[model samples]
Target: MKLFTCTHCGQLLYFENSQCEKCHYPLGFEPKQLQLFPLVAEADGRTYRLFGTTQPNAPTYTYCRNHADGVCNWLVPAESATQFCTACALNRTIPNLSEPEHRLRWWKLEIAKHRLVYSLLRMGLPVVSKFEDPEHGLQFDFLADASQDGGQKVMTGHDNGLITINIAEADDIEREMARKSMAEVYRTLLGHFRHEVGHYYWDQLIDNTPHLTEFRALFGDEQDDYGQALQRHYDQGAPNDWSQHFISSYASSHPWEDWAETWAHYLHILDTLQTAHAFGLSVNPAAAPAELGLQAAITEEPYEISDFNRIMQLWLPLTFTMNSLNRSMGQPDPYPFIIMPEVVDKMAFIHKVCQQAGSSAKAAC
Candidate 1:
């Protein structure tokens, strides 16, 4: 995510901000421009025009219908027939809003989902909603478990193209307990979205392509029985040398999981690196020796960078700086995993997959 500014007041703004605090200007994101524009209401009171523009035919826009529920702030062209923005359109089921607590949880989940969508759009990846392509499009369901509603437990996983997330995970206490129980170093709503969506993309981008051969060589064959693989993983646990190739213990459960885990880490790296680049952040401590190789800088967007090595070069130093800041505040490391040589090879494959997808989209255009 990149830093944004209010066009009306030049005040620094965040990705999710709906109004500029300094100027009280209404704001809406322009997806085509990738900008958070200060909005001016149109004469009919149904559309908005950009703050600095005065053209009679300036593009008009309106907030997605989800905005009325306070769960989404994304905008759509006024001329668009769809009521939801690209991101909100992916939602197959939302928590029942009649329950007061469910509203807040839905809002939290939307924040994370929007961020995930933003990154996907930035990478020029396919993001068709289930409504657009019912058979293969991506979709989401925010569901409640048996504890909340005498229903079957909702597991956070992807099947075909639909991803189901238990609304309980949105509760901070519940999420923290699960994190500790699994002995995981890091976990969050955004991480869950990223990881599960990775499964969806694997089906779309690599399943029947030539890339599958390379994917299997690096991540292993995904044809193995998933349920049995997970059973063995929980019963015996990952081997001591798991980190030599896998990104997480859970990743070792199956080849599909390893790909999903690596894919999520790839998104984490690209998004964080882009944020650092937008802010012109550099990690160069004078006291740190050159041989330590902890000094680095980012001058380009990670999504556009074809070289995976360059992305890692900036990522390592950026993580070092981020972890140090977390420690200063007596918090756990923001990024708790190390990228080994074997893992980098897998990440490179993912990088190529994304680059190829982007190129194919452009060529079709």
Candidate 2:
């Protein structure tokens, strides 16, 4: 994520900052402007005006009244009719806020959602509201399906651009059980965001771009019978050859499943490498391959798809060490999925596609 600032004092701040440490300016994100503004309240009820010029003439802002009650920190655009801000507006149905525990989970969900959006926006990808584009806009639907033991709703999957997050995934025990049932080594809320985004981008890129032939060649025919593939997966299980080719066992369910799983891993590796760099680790995914090989000689460091085969070599050892460290703490491995050579190539392909798309967009602008 890019470093943000307190608009008033130019003090470095994080994306999650709601107050300026240097100038005491109350901060709020203006989603329409994609900025965090210095908020000043008018001498009236609960309304507040926005002024921050890191973007001059930024859109005016309205605080989520939940902020007054200390339940939410999200901000909505003053001109928008939506009650939730750009982040919270995606909710289809949240848990019963009447229950104190549900409210607590809601805050945690909101925080993770904001972080996920921030990363996506930083990538310069389009994030249109599903509400705005009922036909094709990207949106999320976070809902709770009877955590109280009477309801029977039991899945969280994607349908087109909408992401349905079973709120039970928010519960620690429930998520862990699902993770175990699915034989997953690692799972988290952030991972869900990355995976769901894979489905969204598949809709945005493959469905919109001229890469149909290449997509089919690499992933398989998109026109394949999806329902049949899923049903076959449930009945017969993933192909035994899944381990040699697909990133996960479930990925063998269908070519589209493979694409989404690979896409999620690409994000995971990139973000993990970024975290390594930010923390002053010696690993450099951007470095030359020969240098990486030399580093790999001493310590297995996280690698980048951009670095070619050298990356996979380094990644395996590094992730192995990472998993061992987690095991030492009596926790599951940090990266549950394997990085096969085929998956590495796909990750490289995605990195290149993103780079080309970004450059193409900028040149057109």
Candidate 3:
């Protein structure tokens, strides 16, 4: 979520930008280097070199096949034989794009998916596609509900390593209606991606691993009947004091949900704090009480920081500022949930788990 710049004209660019507006230079993201570069297409029309590179040995790259439709901006090294970049390669099924609406929805989904993948890559977590390891590799299924065609509704959930999202979630009006009906404070495509991927990572990094026992202790025994738990939750709602222990009311439904909700918020904190750091943002209210914690200086990238406390130190102030800004604009708070002691404990566990996974990846490398 950090800010990006076009290498050619220094124009500020968003992660999804395919071209620099100011200089009209074509822009592409190099995921391996976590950088946005202006591309200099070769005469052969199949390869590109990075802008401003005078070295004869500069690496060349090709766009992912998904880039043809403007749904992706990631670059794949020319030496690689894969037609897709690291992020787009995970797709198992994309919505039928013959329909105009599905095309727009799929494009939106890709933006959120790419952002999610960017965070995973930054954490040094594995990004294997289902094609690479059919049993447990990550994959996406962007599907539309078939109710109109007399089939079952496509639910947005994760199974094994496959994450299926109902394409309707990409539509703002439909998503807003769902948020209101579910009585949720926040519901977004990005949140859904983060939460579901948490389940996939649980399978990869924690299940049957040494961390399972600790996870059970913190999240309660996930062995509890999941189906019955969810049915009971829908029938009898979350406890009145659910906020004291869970990140969201839905999180109280099951131990697995609690982990996923907490994991999503952990990601929320990291990405938001990184954006704040990029802007050199700090909060220091001269008239505010010291105990209010209305002051913090974001001096380090939250993703690079190992300590959970330091992450919170930057996150709390930034959320306060974000909420205040929204209020000033007569809009709802961008972040509405509160983080109590128990929720913090859950998030701390997630932080530790990610650190362990990252270290394992590093050691193997």
Candidate 4:
């Protein structure tokens, strides 16, 4: 979510940009470096040399095979012998591209997926693809509804490590209708990706770990029957005080959902805070009293900040300003959920787990 620049022309580039507009330089994202660099084709024409590297034997790279479909801009070191980058390799199924509209929907899905993958990698979390570990590795399927083929409707949910998304959600009208029908304040393609992947990481990071005890205590016992819990949820709706305990009404449906919803919000906070930090954003209202503590300065990356209190401190004021700005522009608030005390407790647990995961990865190195 941080801003990026083209190495060749210093043009401010976006995460999804495949070329620098100013210099017309071909661009590819270097995940290891977390950079977008200009690419030059090598002598054999199958690999590219990255610009701005002085090493005499710098590794040549190639874009993920999905790049050919215009859905990926990430690079893979040519020597690694993998056709897809870490992110693209997780695909279990892609919407049939024979339909022109499906191609555009797939492109929209990839944008969200890449951003999700970038955050996971930035946090040093494991991102093994299903191909690498068939039993437990993560996979994704972008599928169409029953209307497309007289079959079952594709529900956007996660089972085991596979996340299935309804491709129609990429359409603005379809997604908006679903949001209203569900009585949700905020929903988007990125939110769906974040929420489902949260389920995947629960298996990878916390399922049998020591954190499970605290997780159960905070998020409720996930051991409860999921199907019945959801049935009850839909039958009677959320509790009147749901906002006091859960991030969203849907989160109140079951313990697992509560955890996933909180996890997704935790990610939203980290990525948004990181973007704020990248832009050197700070919030201070001259008219506010000092006792309100309504000031914050984002001095460090959110992932590196171990103090959850510090993150929440900055995030609250940032969201307030952001919402106010949106109101001024006659647009809905970009962030519509509130982070109450109980939600904060769950988010802190997530922050601790992610920090521990990052530390464990470093120690193994």
Candidate 5:
């Protein structure tokens, strides 16, 4: 995510911030502009104009309906007929908010979902909601397990275009326990969103398209029985040399999973590189030996760079700096996984797919 600051006071703000802490001015993210504008309420009490613009022709916007529940900070133009913003419109089911705990869980899921949508928009990928295209449009279902309510245990996965997330994944303790049990190097709500959406995009951008042949060549044939693959993985675990060919042990379960895991990492790299570029971050430790090749910089947006090698050049050094900082603070590495050449080859394929999708969208527009 790009760094944001309040226009009124330049106070650094999080993507979820509803108001500038320093100026106390209300804020709302305008998706088209990719900006969190300080808002000035209209006298009619229905819409808000941007903070400093006085022209009568200036556009006005209103918060998404989810804003009333403090789950969204995105805005839709006042002229728009829809009540939900691009991100919030993806919701097909939200946990019952009458239960106090459910409210927090829903909010947490929304934060990650909103960020996921932001990345999708940044990549110029399609963001149609299930309401727009019931058959294949993206949607989310935040559900509780049978242990919490009276339904079957909810699994975090994707089916067609609908992504189901167990509300328990939002709980830190539960997520940590699952991570340890699975022996995952890293896991988070955002990671889950990115991974599942990868599946949705596979259905949209690759399935039955010309790209499918190349995808099969790169990620292996996804036609293998997915359930059997996962069952074998759980029973016997990954191959001893899994890292030589896969991004993670779970990724070794199936061709589809390998693609999804690589896709998630691709988004991870793009977002983190964007954040670094936003902050003008670079690694050039003066005292470090020159032979280590530690000097690096992010001179431009990762998404704009078509060269996968350039993205990795900046990514590896940034991870080194980030991991060092985390270790210094006695915390786990922010980027715990390695990007071997084989994994990079897979990621490069994802980069090409995303680039093509972006170009196709632009051409249609």
Candidate 6:
């Protein structure tokens, strides 16, 4: 979420900006350059702008064919044959854009997906779409079957590195129904991306890593029956002591559920805390339930990052305030999930994984 500039006019800009206000130059996000830069277009259809153009060709200019089609924000290297750019290249499947409104929804979905990728990239996680490496590379397909009243029913979840999201997630009513069905606190396009990516990284960061045993110790043996756990969860409901052992009632389903739920919350907390800091709210306090601040944090920096102590310190009070605010608005609590101390420890593990990946990506950069 760093500041970007207009490649042509040097206008201060945002990641989502489509046009530069000051210079009127078109703006886009270049994945390879990893910056918001300007573009130069020729009538023949090839479009590009110099890499670090304002700073001289630090690297060769990158091009995005989507820039021509007006769908993508990323840029690929000059020598790169891929037209979609690294981020867009990750798409295993997208909804049919022939319907027009589908394109708009698909556009919004891509924006959320890119934001998820940005956060993961910020944390240094590997994001290989299933297309990049069907055997081992992680990726997603934002597929929609016939889920709406008229559309086909598409499944939403992760499998063998592919995550299919019902395009109906873009439709308000369907999303709300699914949220109620799952009994989730926070359900959003971004949250889905984070949760599914968590599944992907379950392999990349934990299952494949040297700390596999430690992961098993914290989350318990993932070898336990998964499908059966879900069946039992739906049949018997969560245990009476769910609050004591699980963050969400759903987490009581299984270890994998526990992991994904915690992972999603970890992202939520970090992002919310970042927003808080950017808005100048209090950060990780020393004690629980500090005086609530209505304002967001002045400058976001995850205080306890990968450490349990600070996250707990910050989370307890912040969550309380979040709930209170929702109550004031007459809406359900924004974060219905809870995190026990043991769960806090697991979240710390996720922070560590993200930090390690971030370190690797930064070093390579």
Error of 1 at 123 (Å): 0.2
> Which residue ranges in model 1 land beyond 4 Å of their true spot?
148-151
Cα-based lDDT for every prediction: 0.91, 0.68, 0.91, 0.91, 0.91, 0.71
TM-scores for the candidates: 0.97, 0.78, 0.97, 0.97, 0.97, 0.83
Residue-level lDDT for 103 in candidate 3: 92
Clashing pairs in 3: none
Clashes of 2: 0
lDDT of 5 at 63: 92
**Pairing residues by index, what is the TM-score of model 1?**
0.97
Candidate 3 Cα outliers beyond 4 Å, as residue runs: 147-150
Q: Estimate, for each residue in 72-112, the C-alpha lDDT of model 5 and write its tens digit.
A: 98999999989999999899999988888999989999999
After superposing candidate 2, which stretches have Cα over 4 Å from the reference? Answer: 2-17, 20-25, 30-60, 64-83, 147-150, 283-321, 360-365
Looking at model 1, the pairs that clash are: none
Q: How many residue pairs clash per model? A: 0, 0, 0, 0, 0, 24
Clashes of 6: 24
Q: Residue 120 of candidate 4: its Cα lDDT? A: 93
lDDT of model number 4: 0.91
Residue 343's C-alpha lDDT in candidate 4? 93
lDDT per residue for candidate 2 within 1-365, as digits (tens), equals: 43467766888876667778888878887654556767776556455677532454544567865566454566876676777766666656666778777776776676777877765654556667777887777676667766577876846778878887776677788789988997776678777877887888887777768865677777778687999988998899877877778788877888788888888777676555544544444533344475444244323233223354655555554576677679999987788776666777677666666656556665776
Runs with alpha carbons beyond 4 Å of true place in candidate 6:
1-12, 38-45, 50-63, 67-70, 147-152, 283-300, 303-308, 317-332, 360-365
> Candidate 1, 37: how far from true, in Å?
0.8
lDDT of 4 at 93: 96
**Candidate 5 clashing pairs?**
none
